[model samples]
Target: MFDLDLWREIFQSINKNKTRALLSGFTVAFAIMLFTILFGIANGLENTFEKFFIRTAENAITVRFGTTSKPYKGLKIGRQVRPSNKDLDYLEKEFGEDIQYMSPKISRNYQVSYKKQKGGYTVTGVAPDYQYIEKAEIKNGRFLSLKDVNNKEKICVIGRLVEEDLYLKESAVGKYIDLEGVQYKVVGVYSDGGGDSQERVIYLPYTTIQRLYLGKDDIGDISLTYNPNLTVDQALALVEEMTIKLKNRFDVAPNDQRGVRIGNQVLTAKKRLDNISSGLGALIPIIGFGTLIAGILGISNIMIFIVKERTKEIGIRKALGASPKSIVSIILLESILITTITGYLGLLIGVGILESIGSSLERYFITDPSVSSSLLFSATIVLIIAGTIAGFVPAKKASKIKPIIALRNG
Candidate 1:
């Protein structure tokens, strides 16, 4: 129902008490604005964390060798612990079901040249499965094959930036690149999510690298992805068991941490998720309390004051035969209108601020900071409902006032 006369009365009251209306509106607006911005920043922090972790395979585990920190059996402390191809085979044979993809890496920096365009870049020798473990996308041809590894062929896969640097917009596939005076044909070009540093590199068959560089089967590290179906706890348990077995195999002390270091992505991701969940859990209540205080205390106090100030006018209206419903309607509608409009205004302002400054906050680990549309809508509805309830209490009292008593009190 359209009620022009009722709305006119409500508008007149608001216009007359502009300061009071503005003050009441300000409290709700400020609370909602703070709520929106805080949530936006929290979401951005989550985005940053996700981006950091997505650079590598989610199930990846890396084993790196270091000098033994403690003596075991007849071996002395400070003995260098090196892994070899035999260890890779042993892992496959022992826990083949738990493994998904495995690769042995032997990395060295070499002066690479393609027709006079020369650059110093990392050259890594890896098995065919290294592509999946590294999450490398084949842009041109194909990655290292099983035949390449078996034959010890001098074929290589170059990163996207490596191709760009040396080939100058031309494809690196089917071309020969000189690596420290040894010519290796480019079999493929790859792109990685890990950014430019990961892209400025080259990959070759592990056997070829062993024969050409070390003249042995020694590898620098082992990288593998565990079965994706394994739970986090199961993955962790697998790593622990594998660690103990490797230590025993090498005759190192059971508790020697440096002899064989295993890095598990599952453990790292769990810790990160726990931290983020805890932070968000703590934050949500504080923001809720702030908005609650604005609604229950701020709006209630102001509505009470407005009713007290208008006692005489309420009495006059009652004396002039105005109904109790009309009095209640005027005050309640005024509260709802102010709260709804101001809450939405605050939401818009908060979103605008995030849009303008989100890019600059990257250093602070906040990315794409903004609130969801549904969340903004929900906040506004809550404010409106709060305002309606707050107004109802005072409006009910005002309606029950005796005209004579109200006049005398005024």
Candidate 2:
């Protein structure tokens, strides 16, 4: 089906108006290129959120109690909402099977000092289950054991920051560090790096903090893991129910004292990504369509003018027994050939630029971004259709002109 003459004419016409054609084709390519990059960046962000949240148990809900600003139900304003061991025990008994992992957190900013070398770091109270639920990575030794918690052992897990500060000159495992005059054995070192959901935390046992320091048994927060495949409505309802039940058991206002906060606010990060991805998904088509229309219009206009300039030649071809379909097919093939070649080139350049700039741009906000082949294929298909249609109308009009009239006009 490939005609050598038709291809020769397509190349000749494009070569004749090289600058104009190149500029027009570049327009079409630019539109698709922008869409492709945006789509990839959006998917990357969604992936980042997925990696951060989806690796753990599906229905994982975290509980945090912060100070309430207002006095509710005859209570003082700015009341601190602290969670106790009783609330942890109660939730465990209540949500038993529905929950997969239940871990309590006790976090505070402290200066972990080993005499001369001291640095500010976060001290977290965590148990063995914290590793599974939060996905903590240990570089050496091991995390706090059940025995550590049960026996109130004065052993701590150091973070990378602590390692750099306390034993930066040496290995952190089996090192001793001070927590405000309390000396604890460094049993492990965790390498979590840093993330939006997770921070650099040095973990110790809850009982160790309470029994060793003669402090209260108040836990900072609670982490509950559930199935994540549930719907947004289902997740919200479950957390809402759990929060009410917890408040009632503690005889505190759900909005105030004995207060507890439930639900993964970071799960709502999915909302942010979904918004961008869906919006960009929709926008890509609009831009592609717009560029397609412009390309079609340009090719149609140029072909109509070319036919007008070649009225005498068209008249001679008609008189020489050229069929209407032949005339139209000739023009359409030229248009399509030009568009297909230039459009592909533009796509390559655009994709190259995107690949080049992607990592550099992602550091600020977007994560790893890359385009999909399906989307590019779809764009190419659209360009081909536009080119064919643009040529068809003009070519058909040229074919209908009478030999006598075209000859006279020329």
User: What Cα-based lDDT does every candidate model obtain?
Assistant: 0.88, 0.72
Highest lDDT model number:
1
lDDT of 2 at 133: 81
lDDT of 1 by residue, 1-410 (tens): 99998888888988998998899898888877877887888888878776766667878899888899999998999999888889998999988999999999899999999997999999999999999988999999999999999999999999999999999979989999999989999999999998999999899999999999898899888989889898778889989999989988888798898989789755767667757767776876577657656665788888888888888988998999989998888889999988988888888888888899999999998878878899888877877888898899988998899999888887
Estimate the TM-score for candidate 2. Answer: 0.70
Q: Candidates' TM-scores?
A: 0.81, 0.70
Q: Which runs of model 1 end up more than 4 angstroms from their true locations? A: 1-8, 51-55, 66-71, 75-82, 93-100, 135-155, 173-176, 180-188, 211-216, 226-237, 255-258, 264-273, 352-369, 400-410
Candidate 2 lDDT by residue in tens digits, 86-201: 87788878877567777888877777788688777777787688877867788889998999999998899877666765776788788788888888888987766345324356
Which pairs in model 1 have colliding backbones?
none
Residues forming the 10-long window of minimal summed lDDT in candidate 1:
287-296
